[model samples]
Target: MLEKPVNEAPLADVTPPRLEIRNLHRSFEGRAVVDDVSLRVMPGQVTCLLGPSGCGKSTTLRMIAGVEMQDSGQIFVDGKLICDTVFRVPPERREIGLMFQDFALFPHLSVADNVAYGLKGSKADKRARVEELLVRVDLLRFIDGYPHQLSGGEQQRVALARALAPKPRIMLMDEPFSGLDNRLRDGIRDETLAILKEEDTAVLLVTHEPDEAMRMADEIALMRDGKIVQQGAPYNVYTRPIDRASVAFFSDANMLTATVEGALAMTPFGRFLAPGVPDGTAVDIVFRPQHLRIDFDRAGQGPVPTPVDGTPARAVVERARFMGNESLVEFRLDHDGSIMKATVPAVFLPAKGKAMWLTIRRDRCFVFPSEGGA
Candidate 1:
């Protein structure tokens, strides 16, 4: 046999994506609900489909679950075509597990029976699967109990066990923990995440809550108007947002408007670089409230500028309130009288009308073209 070339490219993996969507589209009465949306999830990874209501997040999930048909594009599992314009697989045979907001447990069935509902095997095999999942979810003691006998969290766990009993390769969760009590929601969500990861199931969770997506997702697909505006890891999606709306979606934003003269937009804070932007362009400088640095006005003068903080801006406290974890101070700018907010940790409740100096981190701020600007 000939010696292998030293620089030969490595062969691609024989295993394909556990779930993949390619330019999926759906419409209703000429309105495009899900337009050319595509995404992929690998084994044991969790990808969150995050967006406001009516943005097609759930519709996309429905299409993937094989309940809703797409108008175009293809769905694939392990490189095998599952759904498209003409051909499709049955939802029950898709090997995908589903967990919804409602536990959807059968009231008449026992916990063990509910879990064994989807399993295909002899009686002994089904019972073994049910017992295994019940132990994993810590509900083995409830084996003989009916769904109505369990608390909200316990019922949800039983639902989770039922979904996992078949050992699905992909799990589609649609706000599964949203209905639980606040105290139980976090714990159940964490437990479910741990179990899914342990089972090596690719999870596609749909939720509008940013906190859930940030804490639970390995990847986030931010959808809007039937299109994904950005997709990335949680850190990148939050810190390196693609546009102004993207920033506002994750947190409250304070925007300062200025026209670019020479690749810089001047504000009371300082001139921020607008690299590659035209000289005559109008831009908006946006920063989160937590990025604002507050200091007492020293003898009616703001502090000197620094490279890290850019420049100090003067403002008067319009309102201040204690928000438990932090104090929020609203200010009216001295330069333009525009309102902005600052959040300081701890119990800081400054009197209204108090004058203060504020500085902003240039690196923490984002500059985007002002909406509707030429």
Candidate 2:
């Protein structure tokens, strides 16, 4: 079990990263599964690899754990080489811990025995370690119980205890909270994060859920097509995405097409700056659903232009659904009959076929040159 330091020394700002990988690549069946992946995790920091399933996140984690070898690249810990093309280190000797969705506790072993499986020491030391980890995970009462005797949440805690018993320098977790019920997952994730921080272990977490990444990560590496498309803090990555796909990944996006003229793109929402783009270039004005504001129609007249919300565009309500704290309303654009969505806080249900004016917050919108355009 990992113990809190009695006299903890402050980490120097100049300390090197705990885990680093450079230009990692892996392939199977003639297709590249993990392509030129590279990332770093600082001591006590959690970096989440977030992307769609089959995007090679798990494969990348496996490569780091040395369960699978990379075709190329180098793995290092605190400036010391662990693996490269010519040199290699075994996974068991690397001092890294792993936790996965399936807790995979031994059904036959007692909770204390399972946690002590990877520990090496005298019997008393092992027992002490097991007891300490079980206590940290709030499962000390289950120490003598078999895996089958505990609930799913309790079993997961046992698995966590087992992983931390060895006091590894780095921890790799692949959707560790996925198996828990939704109501239970958040609390467990918080507890696990707290434990990892207390142990001062570097963490590389893999998850396809953006919310999970946002909540748990110190930094997020947004992966797609076997490559990291963007890496930054959650707020920066969400608000300053590099492309249309990156923006759409985190929320429902609404887009309007426009042609550039005089260094600006004219849309029903009004003109948006298209800086450095040549005239006649096609651009896509993208904004999130929550940024769209709904106003009642004054006969056929839409709302007046404002500095913040450029211009109100007319639309007919197609459908509306209550979503807890907000209502999602879909509208059919009057100008081109395109479907767009808007979110309104609280209960504001407008009838179907009712005309409403929708204005987008200019600061919340992004203008990107259309794909396949010059």
Candidate 3:
């Protein structure tokens, strides 16, 4: 008999998710805080829990860190059950590191001592680990200095070093970069991500800032009203949003209302295909500001229609502002007199009341069934 090929050999190298949560639920005063939240973060991956305030992002992190007990559901680390409704693991015993906005460094202890706080083993081992982590964060020279002697960014580095000293399987960071100055935030974020990736730790970071999430996350979990509405790669979540709210969350969105007929939604510019939506259903056609094209008017008439951009519509510029990288121009359409916004990649600030033709890229727009409409 011929030897059978073993499929398990190739899959053996495929590492399982380092952290996993299943159907996690928490409620406050009969109000659901985190409802049926489920997600997974693989080793060396940075997953950001992104949303506005009061979205239960912090609560989810707290639960994973074993600081807050989930009302229901299970938490797993490397496929091992750690916590659920009844079974639990103490925060200290969970092998999970936490870095919050506040550095929370020991005021009385030196940098070396702070980093070595969670470490164990012989004195020499602890000292070596402390020195190694301090070196990683480029704070080795300040090992003997106390927390107050350092700046906010330095303190954050120390906090990160301390958190990683124990080699936790999962790291929970709640807006750790929020306290740093704008100039320092980017640099520190890059450095921290590099260090965490090197350590192969699964990081679950919580932040309300979309830019931060887009910059740092390998995967983004977009939460709203205590539930995750969408989760995917940053580009996928941004480009292929599931709903109007998801689109508006990332950037300025231009929307127009229309009713579906023959699987198409008609607008002033053109028709948008709303496949799967029933006929006679009201829908919203949405597109980002960048997708709207501006053109010069020709004797009060706009440009002819094209396959990709559909039709050009006449509009009057209401306002224009050069926002460093791009220019934002708002207009009032002549057909409907409704406000619409567009962005130019360069400085092309037209004066207010200037007449301009507008066209939307048909391929870039999204059509969704209107909320509260059948």
Each candidate structure's TM-score, on Cα atoms with residue i matched to residue i, is 0.97, 0.95, 0.96
Lowest summed lDDT across 10 adjacent residues in model 3 is found at 7-16
Residue-by-residue lDDT tens digits, candidate 2, 37-81: 999999999999999999999999998898989999999988789
Reference-based lDDT, residue 1, model 1: 94
Per-residue accuracy of model 1 over 255-278 as CA lDDT, tens digit each: 999999888888999899999899
Candidate 2 residue pairs that clash: none
Candidate 2 vs candidate 3: the lDDT winner is 3
Clashes of each: 0, 0, 0
Give the clashing residue pairs of candidate 1, or none. none
Q: In TM-score terms, which candidate is top?
A: 1
lDDT of 2 at 260: 93
What overall lDDT, based on C-alpha atoms, would model 3 receive against the true structure? 0.93
